[model samples]
Target chain A: MPAANGNNAGILKSGHDARLLSRSNKCGNTSGLAPGYVQTNLIVLPSRYASDFRLLCARNTVPCPLVAESATPGHWGKIKSHLLGIDGETLAKGLDIRRDAPKYNVYVDGKLHRQDCEDIVTEWTDDHVAFLIGCSFSFETALADAGLTPTHTARGRNVPMYRTTLPLCAAGVFRDSTYVVSMRSYPASEVERVRDITRPFASTHGEPVAWGWDALERLGIRDIDSPQWGDAPLAKIDGKPLSSFKNNEAEVPVFWGCGVTPQEAVMRANLEGVVMAHSPGHMILLDTLDVETIRKF
Target chain B: MPAANGNNAGILKSGHDARLLSRSNKCGNTSGLAPGYVQTNLIVLPSRYASDFRLLCARNTVPCPLVAESATPGHWGKIKSHLLGIDGETLAKGLDIRRDAPKYNVYVDGKLHRQDCEDIVTEWTDDHVAFLIGCSFSFETALADAGLTPTHTARGRNVPMYRTTLPLCAAGVFRDSTYVVSMRSYPASEVERVRDITRPFASTHGEPVAWGWDALERLGIRDIDSPQWGDAPLAKIDGKPLSSFKNNEAEVPVFWGCGVTPQEAVMRANLEGVVMAHSPGHMILLDTLDVETIRKF
Candidate 1:
């Protein structure tokens, strides 16, 4: 049982438990809320963009894995998911997506319209579709269990994210979107063990795509000290090839496909519709489907 | 030593060994010619499209892993490669790109201009950049050693390829590009073994992206009986959901990122520039690099 400290109950037993927590603590991060379930990043958009958005997840499976998507437009309550061959685990039948998540960030024409909304029930319409993307938090426990806890989590900070030179496979209207990767630094010796632990968790951004100092330069990331989102890694890089990091030169940076990749895509596309996403670190946890079952092998 | 049957030295000691054979046996497929070497797909285009094409490879790393790339506009001969951090293992010095490949397919304005050309010397220009992409053949020996030989290879046929509905992350001027996948069928029980063996070979198209019947519908591949290129798999299908196969229904379909993906992208982009590629199954093999050294882990 996870610490449902703010929950009416002492611990979370299911996805609804986290949603119940969300109702009271509307702006809290869902990082450690649900212990044995799926936590997902949310993207609710107009039906017209749904097809293209769905295609985006299909092509870029690592960054935008589909956990539970509405079978049709406006079926937010029943985001039926049958991913990686799990028999259609419906998320708490009639689990209204608009009010279930902890926080919402609404966008209009690709720019940030509003942030920290408790529920977007007023924003719901028959024309809008909701997509539930697998979140990296779902696999953090697995890493921690394997004694490979991420540096950010150990430091009690959000994982740093950077916009990469790598482009997302563009779907209809979602053109020219650069990939955003979340960064975590590990000891050089622990990097391979970290990758091996997370590779099977395909539902989440499975494995680190880039590692070490050279990879940042390769991915076109100009700086290691500054990041696009969250807290930066504890590193004092000098120049082109990162040789010095804090006092430990053995600290290597690892990057994984980020769920924010979709948000960045929607931001760039700037589509003419209300796009709703979860505030960073705030996510919707689903019941029945444990992260353990979401294996590639 | 691989069968450099037409080689003056009768064995392949370096990447140039295959090029020597390419000069005389201009139309032979380089599949089994250079064992223990990296075999690559060729893509030569005007320098203007090189940046976007590079981005395409960076974004879609699985389908288009970068083994070696032309650093400048016309450094085709000295294709300096430092991929996966091998400390710049340059291929055979002055290995002329124009006349080395076994066969070339030149496209003008995205239409097939010529086929089965011995050399593309006339097509070379100061503005052309040659991109050498990692090919799946670089790992076929690994698969074969693991006893997971692809059905097509065992039957002496080219691997079947299909244009998937999944779109490529569109780069500049390369809009609305769909992904193309190469298919191989295997016994259902051996699928996991196949994935484990190939997952580390990141230089080549690494693991199977999709497998089983459901994956076809998910990728929007309608017909399994007919493929866009190469020979169709040993399959028998009737409708939407594929359940039946050639007697042994235990045979499951496995798909990897095809080198043909770039060709499909170039074909769809239909740019106003000359484009060149190796014919299917024909590739350039490089020395000093083995498929084993190109591990992700």
Candidate 2:
């Protein structure tokens, strides 16, 4: 890891930059890197699960918006240039999926074998197919641009996440997956502004699934103080780990579809072979797709 | 048949109105009917083809945007309430699929056996499933609202359609299908405005697939005057079949995904069982979805 302070800040500008950092194994996590470009959540699975996973994303597009997928198993160098959104304009430039991401979480027989492995060169087999999903981080950049800065960003902590009771439309052997949402808090008065800015990025997470105090309850979230991952919700400090910085004011919690959803679904299925994903908060940046006008009308 | 003067011109106000007219065999077609509501293209097939058809629509979203589908074979009472778009809001109020559309085309072993059948109560079988698709006519109203009236609409003729060389992504049994586009002519100066107005209606064929003179040649449409369906291209005619309105000034032809695509594909498959479709111009109107902002971002 870099020092307690960010040693590699303001320099990571493109996919090549991030890929170089990860290839060197010097990058910690990929938050706040390549601010204006598109980043994807990666998932490499066996060929047997490809058809079911395709149907899964199609049936439940909101939470599991598919950007592109490999044309053939084990061929991680390219994707099918679907003419939807920016795939047609982007997929021409190709990169090695194994080393492009800052890190990879290898799951063996439905359990995480390792996290932050820099590259998956050895774990990759001839039957693996890579799927790159649209990330909420694309719209998060939009949120910061629109002046609704998320609380976690200001506090310098990762966005809080929770696995909710909101079930996904299942397909084939992947029949037991539910929705997982990333949370950002803003004042109650600015929820509409926050919604409008994010709703345009349809390929990304799009609009807030729910907001306000009752929002968590509606989604069957039990505790606000303790999130499943990331830092705690903004509140009176009672000796909690917030990485310093106080006087925070964001009050209304807004939830959007998390990119980790497909990751969770594939993990829960627990197929006999290997599955790969980008480490949470770490992403693979793309060359195309302007963050401001990704799906903006 | 209705008179040449349009006997039921202003009476089509809702799904209820169109259903009544078709039930009595009085409605000619459903264009310009129930002006503000959503209209759908209907397709019914054997249960054996449902899984493949679902995959086809999922892959080729541009030409085959799925609206809702039957819950069971021969049971069209309700659709899965996917919270995306308007399926959740509209599926509550249901209607009889057998009598909802203005006309049904019965396809027997890949050949059109009959057209303009009022109802298919006798043809209903437990093994048949229905699929409703989005139509481009929904955006036609948006164009007129933005003051870019279609040339064919002003001429008292159906929109011209042509079979293109643009191939659709094949799934299972739907291999030999190409795209069929519905045409509406506009001026060169107003093409951008026309695109801006219609692009947001994503479910309703979104925007024009191609435009300008070279567009027809790109799609392998050799003869501009000879369309496989609907009226001919807007031109100075010597003795062609068009209703009397001569000052037609709309010059440029714009193409959008025609609803007839799925019908043509299913017919080409040449399955052993019966296949059903809505007549090219006739449709079924729905109770929800405001066309002005289906996907206005």
Candidate 3:
């Protein structure tokens, strides 16, 4: 993560402050971190669950791309970057996963308990394995680059994530209910380019699976004024409500695969003890750039 | 391979004729059969060489992409296409590996001996493995789709291929050697788009490694008239010599990973007996389409 205090402020400061708050057990949610670097959702499990988890990732690669799996079981510290020449450095060095995350949630017997990162070190075992799944930071970056601001990012609030009726492919015990997606609204004309841009970033989520105003209604979302995750969009520009573009027409909404999908899978699997993950915004900054990773795909 | 000589005579007859020619030792080469479908280059090796060969493909996937590897050694008839759904039928069904090729060259103990496909199959043992690799037919399709005329295709000739000084990454017993590339030309303005278009088709040679007329001359070829593998361009179009549009405006000639590289590797390894490949152009027609395979990447 980039430094927050001195010359860097605003967006960059938020990342630094988040890291500091996370280190102090103050801010556990990573909705705000380094502005440019990617943030990933993490899943840690035992080797016994590794193969099944691998299968789950393979089956639902769009949602749970296995960006970097531990080279071997029990070595949570060694995350290999797929790009050659950069490996061996621990992701924990610059950002401590346990301390840097704003909040750490513990799942024991599939029940959730809020815990600080330091409290869970005793739970780390030789049998444990860690997986870093791609997150939506880049997608958000893409959206922002296209001049379509995500409401959550703009308001400094967590992006609203919802569990959908879409069922994920089951791999062993690691079965996830459909998908949990992040919604953003854009004008109809911009949807095609968004879809085109996101298509190459398949590991990140790929293209939008559904787009339209009625999508929220179809998903049984009743209230538009109050969101389950983040603040609702500010006033609509012009007469039309802010809509995600679909086929050159302004769509009422656009939905994309979210990082929470994998987290939900890990939770549903009901593994014993605890599973570790990066709290939302914080991520393992890879030595290789996004373009190189994209090229590998 | 699709059975020709039926109602789809215009296209089917040419395929049927090619197949018939294979039976009588008159097929010449399988280059132009069933024009639109993917054509493959073939490489056969003993099981002992399989792992090394697999590594060779992995290390230098561009030229020697392992489209299909025999499930188990010596089961030549059990081939499967990696990108395409084409199943492994006998290489001997419609075409004879030894005799069908317009020109069949054999190597024993690292020395060359020209022989027909049948002459080599007699030496086939359970230990032998066959590998089918992607070729340039798809790239040619891309060039045509881009509206750039490939001179060789328009003139009814094989695209000129050359053995260059570009060394391939070696694996195990396979030593590094300069690459062999097929060439077609387009004007300078079209080169960038051609590169952009073909870059996605990594399975079939992808982008060119070099460009410009002088680069070809630097590779020790004096006369453009004397092409190493196929006919020269028919004529200069709009002041530019009809060459590989695949090449960039940069001095380096665009070289894609050719399926022939692995064939050459297998020959260079010199395990024993005769190795069979698609009779140059007469490739096995796959159920998979080019666009579908591109989507996978």
Candidate 4:
């Protein structure tokens, strides 16, 4: 069993055991686990909805980039291997998927119902299928590596997310929905560098879809007061905001694709059966590194 | 038929006829036809050797990228569609596989007999399969667009090629062959710019595999004389050796993987049958744009 430290260093020490820990519920939030390793958003659905979902992913690749798909029906281990590279022997080894996640949000008919890992397993059906979409955390690490600290990471915020006007391509039961974007602040000068660095991380949302000071306002976001998830980053200069003045050298906000797109799609589908996902900040830590994952296919 | 002239004006003037013209062998070389479109290098082999060849391509992606494989046995058109995005209807409408190339080199038992296109159709076997790898023309155009003209293009010579000491990863019959590299000379100042521009052209051999003047000589390519493929570039400025006469300026030589790797591999396989390829300069123009092809996959 791997220790549940929520940092990249701790994740690296755990190695393959981290996957087991994630499956076993021994490890907690995957926010910082398996540093430099690729983490993916999970989406499992019935076989009937697979083709449409595949098309959906293809059309909206930026948000829901399809890394790999299940090879056959009822072959959970193979599908998991395609995504996590876990073999049958490993699957037979038995993983505690339910307890690993700190929390799991269950959706029924597009409505959210809190369910721990154990409850979800009972909902699983023989026809259920899954998808592992790319997440922004990989690219965020890249940004941090480049010496630009993402505001959310520094402040321990959830990373502010917004529903944007950019509509997704509709596929079968998956209807068009505004893309969800997560924002982080940085010095204006770092935006281009950030863009260039993130461009190559295509599997992890690639480059930003939009950028500008008024972008939030354009998207009908007002006040910037209330945030949907995570704490709002404090705009400060030299570790402090002026008591009665605006600072000109504060960080500027930038946004990237969040991994919630497919989850949102799954929720919208309102399918009768079950769908599976990693709990918030809890990801299946694979043996594959981010660069290797990008290079393999 | 498409005009043989290079650039968009020629493509616009030729339109759909370009396809027919390419097939008619009216276009001497597919180099300039369908500007902005991708041009592919073709390789065909029997199914018995398909897996080996596929592995070979995967191993030596820079030189023998496996863009598309036959979806099933006896389905040549399906492979073409996947690679060129041309529909089955378009292919059935009629494609003169034979005589399509301005020229085709027939190889048997690892030796080139003569350059001709007639052998393609008669050579086709029920078990034969084909692959379309990327060519350098696309990258050359991209470099030119970025204001970095390749010296070979400017000097009106085939890109200088040499078999290097660098051994490509072997797969099956493709083993122990040195990488064939195309060299271009650029000022030291432009090295970074050239690297930046060419790195994205991964399908077109990506960035240079190596750099340096004597780097080739160290690889056992001692004689700068007795050129391999193209005319020798001018090495003297005002009767003084160019490399040494430049005062304080430095000139660096760069090398890229040549398209000849696959052709070389086919010949080395010594398989008894017909193998098809676009003539030295002739190529299969694809509907995909260069940018899209090179875009981060």
Among the numbered candidates, top lDDT falls to 1
lDDT of each: 0.72, 0.71, 0.57, 0.59
Q: Which sections of candidate 1 miss by over 4 Å?
A: A1-11, A25-27, A87-89, A235-249, B1-297
lDDT of model 2, residue B295: 47
Per model, the share of native interface contacts recovered reads 0.00, 0.00, 0.00, 0.00
The local lDDT score (0 to 100) that residue A147 gets in candidate 4 is 84
Residue B180 in model 3: lDDT? 71
TM-score of each: 0.53, 0.53, 0.48, 0.49
**Residue B210 displacement in candidate 4 (angstroms):** 48
Superposed Cα deviation of residue A131, candidate 4 (Å): 1.1
Q: By descending lDDT, how would the candidates be arranged?
A: 1, 2, 4, 3
Model 1: reference contacts kept, as a fraction? 0.00
Clashes of 4: 9
Docking category of candidate 1 = incorrect
DockQ of 3: 0.02
Interface RMSD, all candidates in order, equals 14.4, 17.9, 18.2, 17.0
Question: What TM-score does structure 4 among the candidates reach?
Answer: 0.49
Q: For each of the candidates, give the backbone clash count.
A: 3, 0, 39, 9
Residue B158, candidate 1: Cα error in Å is 17
Candidates' DockQ values? 0.03, 0.02, 0.02, 0.02
